[model samples]
Target chain A: MMDLTQPQWVKHVVFHPFEGFEDLRWKKGGTLKYTAVIIVALFFALIAFDRWCGFQFRPLPDAMFSVVPYIMKSVVYFFAWVLGNWAICTLLDGEGTMKNIAIYSSYALIPYIVEVYIQVFLSHILVRAEGVFFSTVYYVGIIWTVLLLFNAIKAVHQYSFTKTVVAIILTIAAMLVILFLAVLFLSLFQKVYVFFYSLYTEILYRLRV
Target chain B: MKNKSRRLLKQCAAAGLVCLLSFSAVSLPVSADEPYDVYNYNYLGEAVPSQAGYLAERSVSGLDLGTTALNAPSDLFKDKDDFFYLVDSGNNRILKIDSDFTQIVQEYKSFKMEDGSETTLKNPKGVFVSPDTGLMYIADNENARALIVNPDGTVFREITKPASTVYDQQLTFLPQKILCDNAGNVYIVLNNTTKGSAMFNADGEFIGYYGANSVAPTAEVIANHFWNAIASEDEKKYRSRSTPTAFDNFDIDTVKGFIYTSTSSGSTDTDIIKKVNPEGYNLFDYMSGYTWGDLFSTWYSGTSYKTKIVDVDIGDDGSINCLDSTTGRVFQYDKEADLLFIMGATGDQVGAFSQGNVTALETKGENCENIYVLDAGKGTVTVFGQTVFGEIVHEATALYNGGYYEEALGPWLEVLKRDGNYRRAYLGISSAYYNMGRYKESMEYAKKADASARYNRAFERYRSQWLREHLTQLLIGIVLIVIGIRLLKYVIRKQKNKKKHSEPAASGSGT
Candidate 1:
């Protein structure tokens, strides 16, 4: 609505699921500030799910707990999807920009992030036998987030239903390729750095001798 | 200051004395001279270093029992009278030793038959003193006969190869191990038979097979089964049928009469160890998914050594002690199939055994005080004495399994104070605390035990109690938070309205 504020728009889009992304695209851009908050919340949500969930529902960490994997799963993986989706959509004549894609993706992730925190809390209260309620709530959150994401991609790119599915599949493939290349790039850089460092050490040793 | 220091020194001496008294109070019958590197699998299936439950007290030969030196002893059995019947295969006789490891009670070398003929045992592989008939069931190995003889060298019944249609006519009845049940039914482990032990009725009649191992449902087996169902006669002829592994040795429970069998076949995973009831069904059907022997294999001398359980002996406390021929380790588990201790490994030392050989095992005393393992490679029986940690574990396990949780707590805690790596101690303590309604303490131990069911049982109670106590405060906190957010929103909106109204004139010159 023209009278609505930025924060109100967030609530409006979430409650109005199907038409939310469409309305936001027609009216104005989605808020980047809210998207940033959601991304950070995603990281915290993953950490809390792994570390703070009740002992009954979650496995005790087998080794020292590390935040690096959570960061890789949450933020890095999310950004990769954003980049991959944007790049694929460009070639497919999709109209969504990279920024818009990032915003909508983060907005769709809201349900999953909130669900993780709720599940963590519920785990403490429910016994092992009463895990049905916990799992039902968890799957509901996951399904809601996935549906929202599908809708967001469709609405943002102005695509039909089948076209959206195709685009989503291509985006996943692109994400994997991008991830592999990035790892390769990083490891190659590390090797090059090590090589120069060793050369330096060898020169120092020869000079000393 | 000098007076206070003097008092502190006196108090320290008293504390030291108290510590010394407690240490002596819990001193073990087994000394610190353990001859083997003992280990037990934890909850994670990792072999963690553990306190030796059985120390190698001493290794002795047949000469130690006032008999000739034993040669390649194959089987060892302790009867109700606390006498050991050692099957000296090399010596071709059965030597009955007294309870104290001191002297030979009787040497059964020859038996006067009912037909007025004197027959001597030739390479007897097994000897069982039947509690029901009070007779010696000797497996005359090389002679291909089972002799039911009295303890005084008088033979009662001699069983030879049966001429029955059910039995293969070409197969020789190489009776390797023999045992007679309460009803006088004799079950004999044949040297070459995959169809299970050859069962004989009280009248010495050839009965049907009993307790045959089922073929493991591996991927290939399942695939073959699927194909065979829809296969033609020609296709079926081409398909290979899976054969079940034969059990090599078995031990009957003294009290329950349940026969526990062990197969030395290391390739197949199923039916490695079993507890069969009188009805011919495995009592361990519920634990079929569990791996009874060492889950991991080791490498020695360029050959992969996997644990192949050659013999199984049920101890007095209903504990199952399995002897692994490849690793030469005794894997002892409680009645509930929970692994308690792993003792001995293959080496040239006094306690260690030589790998890749047949071994015999027997436990002596009420609580399995001494474990005797007859290593054929060295031709000696290594006697292992129970340690203090083992006593505590046994006491705790008995109480815990008996549902006496409160009483088990003390022993389990004492076990923890000795070996913190003992995973069962954590589970035992957790269960005890759970039964006592100490939910918080139960959760702490449950987490350490890596137990989800027990942890959840405790967490549910802890959460409810906390929620009940803080319900009103939680409500108040929620209400305050909602009110504060509403108030903050109202203030912000009002300030924005003022700015919007005032900025209308300056909107044309916006920055």
Candidate 2:
């Protein structure tokens, strides 16, 4: 018998040709895929703005979508959704056709749309005076939670109802584990961030001719 | 050697810096109340009793619970491993039911003696499964002996003791109603016609007998009258009672290592339920008069709430619910965080209780999502699903508003087990695990999350960043230490050179 423990390069190549292809397809999904891409771009944009300009948005931004920015946002969102969908498809099926890929993407987008509506509604009701831009932090939460639930349900359907219930249970459990890690990681980040910032500043000072 | 030292110092400084950055990146649940929620329950009205109490209508058609020829099934138990066991009392056998009560899938005849001869059993009154080993015991009414069945269906031994009493010529004495603690010690409750019950350990060693023909404690001396008020099935109102007699039942609190027997005595106006520890300790006494007027044939069941001493189930945060068998009322004990959520009393046809008697109760699953109720009279087991296990997450979010890292850890871990690749819980679990003193496990789960999303640049970015931060901390710390040391050495050498030059000049002047 083949040594099951050893890594079989030949077998892996033969078995997983489609794996890399799926990732490529996700990256190259046309204009329609721009929604996911735009979402991801907007996410990063928000985070970057928060870090650099300290211009953190909260509540719901009252500004309506302009043609160019809206298109840009759609592209970012398309990439983001593609990334999420690809992550799921690749993880579950290893490889999926673009047609199948779109179908799955739509399934996930249902919850995404719901989450967006929820954030908009909440922003209007709860933090309306603050303007929609101020509620970015809260909106991020709605997006994350709704996506998690939808993904879990989709996962269950792919696996089984039993698996879905079990998945839901395990998701709750994973929360506890992540909480612990976040604490540890957060504390480490604080000390390192300050130290690095100081070190970079000190080097700049000492290196002055 | 100096270069090596410098490298080591830089590594140390880098390590320290990387550690600091990652530490500040994530939020943790550090609040004291980060564990669980506490709610208080108040007294709701009485539980209604069905005139034609719960009967197996679907099976064997029209078999009434009250007047059915078949004996009332007894000994409802869920093994520690969550396997369900029920002693089909009239069948002279034990039925191992699945958690969902899907079928009477497996049956074990416990009445056989060691010799393979069928031991005569009038009734198998009580049953106990060893939590440690799953060994089963049945109290046979006809045989008048407690028979132990090996885990593999063979009769291990029939425990025969002098305390084993047969009912006076009528097969009245229930042979062995047994309860087992975690240590496999068994406490059998034998109903003696002359004396009430004789308690025994697993070794057939008799402990004591209490409350004979006239010695049974009166109902007035107990603590609360939750088991007092009797209600009709429609739950319209309470019925008045002249006198009531209390029946005793036994159960083992495996977690607490206590064997408890609930006892009650009845007077014309008062009804009481007293739960005594196996050591003949009257721990809690229910002596109050009934809130609702009692009926004549009110059957009461006394079970420890999730093995707690209090006749109620308490969440990790101290929420309490006391189940009153008589009134069918589940009282919310805490008024402040009053969560008197009424359930099982839902007026659904299939799920409704024919009688108000809830014989056994247990809180199962990670968050106690389901409550199991065994009504022997009903011949049915009903599960009440909590629509709000998700409520814990919501409430947890509210109290610990910001990323509740500590509180989130418990739920996140559960989520990971449910769905291994779930990222949100994975991210939550990974960070929580690290903070919760489980580093190695955190790595495994985090790696799973990362692996599941390998093609995603965001995950890769975070994962790589984490690794880079780790390595940089090591490298930078070493570099810093090395530079500091070299600077110190150069200064020292310079000072020595200056001293030597000054001394030489002094000598030349003397010459």
Candidate 3:
């Protein structure tokens, strides 16, 4: 039987992992400002990493880099922006100092980095596959799902580690919900953009400028 | 220094303004009563005087069942000794008091049967007094039968379904309420039928059936009684599956010469209640939607007041006190808006209380003087007098009823603001939202209601019986499909392994 009197293990296993590291302490009274800086730094770091990795693909420079690669990169960039925006606002809005907010923001991004590593590994193997489309689609699905699961955990903190791990196992569920809503919004925007763009193009044609 | 002082004064004023705003926000609930309309009745809170323009006199003289719960007793009956019997249904006992209610002259356990026999009464549902002979009638529902008793505690008769109706073990007769009329006739309202017998002058005799025929028995009656002729063939071919009668309970007003009964139809999926009168042959079912023509024509018009009733009683003076227990509220409609109060703070126990269920309602005196409520939960009789401001509050009954719902969204929402896990409050708020035409809000409330209702054993059983049977089959089909797929895959793999093994053996033998 576990000793009821000594509950240090739970404290160690759970709280300590998320506790502030030496460099992660509250930087100033302004938690929001700190979170913004950290997120801005993370975004730049991601861009740098993408650029470093971009050399290997080198999508024929002449062809405006295949639409697929640019589209995927853009999608990832948008998600990263969303993550940074939601996390900074949520974590730093109250008692969080900038440094404390940055710590939480950094912890949240761990899942994204891990997901990117997996994506890179899979791409290395499947870049030569017959149906490159299938591999890309599959990996994209995995990354999208991992990001949604991570975001949901950030949104709701009522569950324990076991429950959260179970939630991760059931990633497709949270993915379905977030993806459906995201798809719906994008489709609506696409229709509106198309309509407006056509109208502008027609007017420009008539003007013959 | 002057500029600094001016800035300080401005800052102080701004701080004071913020303080005032915060204080006002906190005080909103306490000040809610200031805007009370004369017609509005907020009885759920601590008893306060009704607003203005309703009852001029707050106290009733001589009748003091001190600390009693007669607010809306399920059933009321006056016996041979002129003693009014209030089924203090909440206290699980019958309170027998003199007409003026100055004293509780006698108290009887609801378990004592019609023949004065010792039989446990699970719940005393309704109380009735025969005007012809002053005999008392009590519907003891736990035992699932009606008991007739005399003023001296002698059980004259115990009414049950005729034995022939119980043949082949296909019987579903559950008695809910009873009513006695001036002509010495007794009517027992079952879950779906109003079966009764006309008694001879002062004697209990099975005279004949009254009101409508049974829904389940009509076809059987036709089958057995009709001959094997052309008529029989036509009857069998044209057998009608008309809907069952929807009465909830029955009430008789000897003075006014009318019988009142409440009927409800629909399953969990659908439900409706109707108030019906035998003499006028009138029925008021709210589910049919609002019929203004019927409302105008059927209302009891007085010199200055009119009442469109869903459930009502004719007082000794022929005044009506109708109950609208739907929406978890009992609205007392009167000429003066202040007199039109709302009761039943809790949604569970309502309407002439019979054990948490209000089964019947009656006014004690000729001027519609006192309203006696029979609450079956606490099993006590509650009496409420018309207050000077026309507000009526029954303290004990309110406590029991407060559990289901509060009177408004304000109290529930305040709790949610503090701690959201108070599940019952969510359900109550949901019902309030639904009543206010906020369907989306109602759906959210329903989710909470579902979560809380699942905790109740009876409700859980009901849901399982209603939904689980069909759902279980669908689940079983899905499981079978999964198992079938697994078995098919296993068989295919085994066959492939066998082929490989046989090929190796043949090749080795040839070598």
Candidate 4:
């Protein structure tokens, strides 16, 4: 509906994983702000799970005071995946754009984001012997999220399940290539900067002489 | 001028205080001034400086035997009679020194054989005195034989290399170390055999090799096994094969008769240390994958220096002392393989050993009051006497291992006071509190010790007790939360309905 709020739309899309993205697409799709907020919440959920989980269930060997790794895993990895999937889907004549890929993918991640907080809450109350329930909850959340992710990708790209799977594999390969290029760019930039700075220093030395 | 003088005095006092604080910080880790670096690996496998467990007393070399010094004593053993046996390999003799190191009780050089002929030992590397038979087992390295000599320097029996086809006829029998199990079965470590120690029965007839080290399951080894599985029989015969490193030295727990072996093939860390049973199976179960020696190797100019245990000695109190050849350090572990102390380092000082090698390790007295290390390069034995901290740690460890956890609480607390970084003390305290029915306190200490299993056990009981005490409150709290949420939902719906009625078109278009 036109009156559907952002959180309510996300909730509706989550419950209806199969045809959720189709309905969202019919309703002008999603915005970049919503995707960013979802990703930030995902980051926080992961941080809370690691930092506040009970000692019996491993609250990090040493409690991590820094959230840099969690931020990279959640926000940065999500963006990378979205960019990679978009690039692959575009070449495959897919209907999904970069924005739509990010939004749909983030919607799939709601299950995991919810599961982490619940597990974190239960970890403090439950003993290690009763971890079977905790583990079951985690597995259910992860499987549901993965199922949602597959369905979302399929619907957004308007492809068969097999084609969607192939696209995902290609997307992973694309992500690796992008990462390799990123490192290569960074190192080359450092070398160029060093070369220019050395030339400037030589010029200054000549002027001083 | 008088006020200025007072301010200057105050500045001087503050400056002196800062200096004092900085000096205290600098000297915090080193609790004592010693010749060598004494350290122990923490639970995270990082080496931290610790209070000395043993202080190197006097270096003994034939203390009261006048001009006759013990040259390159290869092995040191404390027999059941409390007498010390020193294998003077450089001198080509065995010296039976009294327990007090007061004088050389006896020396064995020229041995009268059963055939009424006399022979002298040539560079004997190992000696073990049996209390029951009153016989001495000596591994005469250069002579290529093991000798069973009587107390009066008479050769009771001589064991030469076996003529069995199982043992390669091409290789010479160069015995490096020898020992006898309670059944009078002799196990000799050959210098050139990876098949394991050559075993001989009571009558000195070769039985077979016993307790060989297994090859590490490395990637290359796994791949080799995979290929060997599919290889044809003819091809398998000519393929290069992987073999296990030879265990260099071993010791037996006189009480349990379990043979504990140490492999000096330093880089091949797998099976570097093992405690074997009578069935020839390695039974060391405590922290099975735990690295026994130094966690990190030091990189020199070209190569990394790793701790390769050349010798092992089982103490009377169930501790295992290992001697490293490269660093000349002694690593001592408790019965549970918890590192208790790390002593000795490479230096030319009296207490320090040479970097080239430290060949022997032995613990003495009823409670292991003194530890003796034979430095082959230095040619002197450095006696390490138990310090106060060590005595407390030993007592606490014994009581803890004996299941007298509650009694060990006091000593563990004392250890924590002396060194807060001692994780074992936290574990002991946690267990003590656990046995005393203080589960909450136990959980607190377990967290400090990083013992998740112990924390879980304690938390289980604590959680049950908590649930029982708060069941009624919990139910009420859940009911209240449900009602509160429902009420909030209704209030929000009412507000939304009012807003819809006020401006229906605007709300629908924007949302």
Where does candidate 3 stray beyond 4 Å?
A1-209, B1-83, B88-93, B98-103, B109-123, B142-145, B163-174, B192-209, B212-240, B264-280, B283-312, B324-328, B333-341, B347-360, B378-382, B389-511
DockQ score of the complex predicted as candidate 1: 0.49
DockQ order, best first, reads: 4, 1, 3, 2
Candidate 1: fnat, from 0 to 1?
A: 0.82
lDDT of 1 by residue, A1-209 (tens): 34456776777677778998898888775778988899899999888888888878889865787788988998889989999999999999999999899999899998898999999999777888888989998999999999899999999999999999999999999999999999999999999999999999999999999
Residue B204, model 3: lDDT of 45
TM-score of 1: 0.90
Q: Is model 4 an incorrect, acceptable, medium or high docking prediction?
A: medium
lDDT of 2 by residue, B1-511 (tens): 9999999999999999999888865422211221111121112222321111011112211132222232456556666666666666776667676655555556666345567776555567777778777788777766767777777777776665554433234434456466656655555565543354654556666555542223334454332233344444454235333322423465554555544444333322221223345455444333331221122243338632221111234322223334445433333222122232334332224334444444554445544445555555666555555443334432432223344667787766554453332344555565565556454456555555442221122333444555666888878989999999999999999987898787876533421
Could you tell me how far off, in angstroms, the CA of residue A146 lies in candidate 3 after the best superposition? 71
Q: Pick the candidate with the highest lDDT.
A: 1
Candidate 1 lDDT tens digits, B365-434: 7678889999988888888888899888988988998889989999999999988889989999998988
Interface RMSD of each: 4.1, 25.7, 29.8, 2.2
Best by DockQ: 4
Write candidate 4's Cα lDDT for B383-433 as tens digits. Answer: 889989999999999999999999999999999888888889999999999
Higher lDDT: candidate 2 or 4?
4
- List, residue by residue over A1-209, the lDDT tens digit for candidate 3: 22211123222212333432212222211134434443454454444335432212322123232444444343444444344433433443323333443334444443354455544444332322223643465466556445444433433333455654554444434445555676799999999999999999999999996
lDDT per residue for candidate 4 within A161-209, as digits (tens), equals 8899999999999988887887799899999999999999999999999
Which one wins on TM-score?
Answer: 1
Q: Mark the 10 consecutive residues where model 3 chain B has the least summed lDDT.
A: B290-299
Write candidate 3's Cα lDDT for B176-279 as tens digits: 56777666666666554434322222354444444442344455545644443435656766654344455565456566556654433222111122233453
